[model samples]
Target: MSISADSIKAFYKDGFIMIEMNKGVEIRFPVSQNRRLAVGTPEQLNNIEISPFGLHWPELDEDLSFKGLAAGDFGQHSGCPTRNRRPRAVAGR
Candidate 1:
């Protein structure tokens, strides 16, 4: 099944990005996980465009798919490197 985002928000102060899914699911991850997001300022990070399938940050020129995010694949160019491993998804509250 394909999951999509209803809305996305970047919490710069908390250093996390949160996505509210169409089915009332919320996924949150650290900003440090994505290279572009890690370095983005509050203004830039907050500029999110949500599509049916994913989220986009035009100011940072970054995109993250809902499927990928659900699978814990932040990005290929993540700020923090993992050793051939995928982090577990954080369930919504």
Candidate 2:
């Protein structure tokens, strides 16, 4: 994992730092062990989310779920950009 000094600094402070990658360039960090995830528009790509090992695009209002990503289908989903923050929990059917 290639990390810059600034990234290191953010990690030390808030435990995370977003990295805005340039368009057309291959992402250095592994999104999910070789599976490259790219947002279609600059509005999507402009915001970067850097967690301990996850990213959250706030502009998109989408929580990029990453655990057990490749093994299941959720990882392959490109969530639609949303602006609502309503609870999505559902009761037992």
Candidate 3:
């Protein structure tokens, strides 16, 4: 329910606050205005590149930037980075 000096220091440094509130962490990785890499305390937080403002899911093998996530531009689509809007399919192709 509370945070300490040491942990707070780590928070600004890593941008991800590891809080023991229930079965998860209050991680706000990616210090962007709107981009927040929310993940579980133990599992979801890891497995990705630990950045102060971003994360890389090794299992998913994907990376996400703050701006990208904010604008919803990039992310895992069919296990790959795809456009946010669907491409128009040809008619009667």
Candidate 4:
């Protein structure tokens, strides 16, 4: 798939970041779901730069890719539960 982001917006109040794709597709996720971003202040979250490949927060040292976000991935290898992992049901009571 072609990876291109037209624009990116961060909502501090809502605690989510939104990425608008070139094809008019928008992807968003909670800031709390990311390792580096979860603890970032509004000021830190606000200091962001958007690239064709991903979103970058220099102050917070955070980066998120359009493809990753679109695929329901916030981050990995950070000890946080991935969005794609489903909880297993208990077999017996």
Candidate 5:
């Protein structure tokens, strides 16, 4: 299923992005979690486009799905080692 955002804002000072969903739920994630977003200036980060399927940062060339955000999946560089890293094989006993 696809989820869409009602509005979005970049709180640069707070170091996170906030999305207000149509269901009155708010989803937030730190900018540091995203590689492109972490490097964006306040102006660039604040410039957001909320589409039916997701959020877009044209200046940063980044797009994140609303469904994914709600699920705590903050793009490829989310700093969650388990999410981004490949599983290592265990040595034979």
Candidate 6:
């Protein structure tokens, strides 16, 4: 599924990044869940630029994709605990 965010806002008090999609769906996630935005200050988070593909915070140098957010991804890369993947089984177990 493809999603494009029409607007985004930083809710500093709640520590959430709120995104409004083109289809009128809103998605939100804790700032701490995202690696780059995890340590950003209120001022840094407030300074955001919204694009058709994603959101960019030039001050904090953080970018989040709309589709990824819609899919429950908050910028955690491979090996990150938030991925929620189970360990593979051994062949000879």
Against the true structure, whose lDDT is highest?
5
Q: Where in model 5 is the C-alpha error above 4 Å? A: 1-13, 78-93
lDDT of 2 by residue, 1-93 (tens): 333323421111122223333332222322332122343244444455655444555655544433432233323333433423587889994
C-alpha lDDT values of all predictions: 0.74, 0.36, 0.41, 0.70, 0.76, 0.71
- Tens digits of lDDT, candidate 3, 10-54: 223354422222334343434322123333233544444545455
lDDT of 2: 0.36
Model 1 worst lDDT window (10 residues): 3-12
lDDT (Cα) of model 1: 0.74
Whose TM-score is higher: candidate 1's or candidate 2's? 1
Q: After superposition, how far is residue 77 of candidate 5 from its true place, in Å?
A: 1.7
TM-score of every prediction relative to native = 0.69, 0.32, 0.32, 0.67, 0.72, 0.67
Q: Using TM-score, give the best candidate's number.
A: 5
Looking at candidate 3, the ten consecutive residues that score lowest on lDDT are 1-10
Cα deviation in Å at residue 12, candidate 6? 4.5
Deviation from native of the Cα of residue 57 in model 2, angstroms: 0.6
lDDT for each residue of candidate 4 in 1-93, tens digit (9 for 90 to 100): 444344445445578776655556667778877888888888888787877777788998877776787778787435655546888898894
Which wins on lDDT, candidate 2 or candidate 4?
4
Relative to the unseen true structure, what is the C-alpha lDDT of residue 38 in candidate 6, on a scale of 0 to 100?
Answer: 81
Off by over 4 Å in 1: 1-13, 77-93
Residue 40, model 3, lDDT: 29
Using lDDT as the measure, name the better of candidate 2 and candidate 3.
3
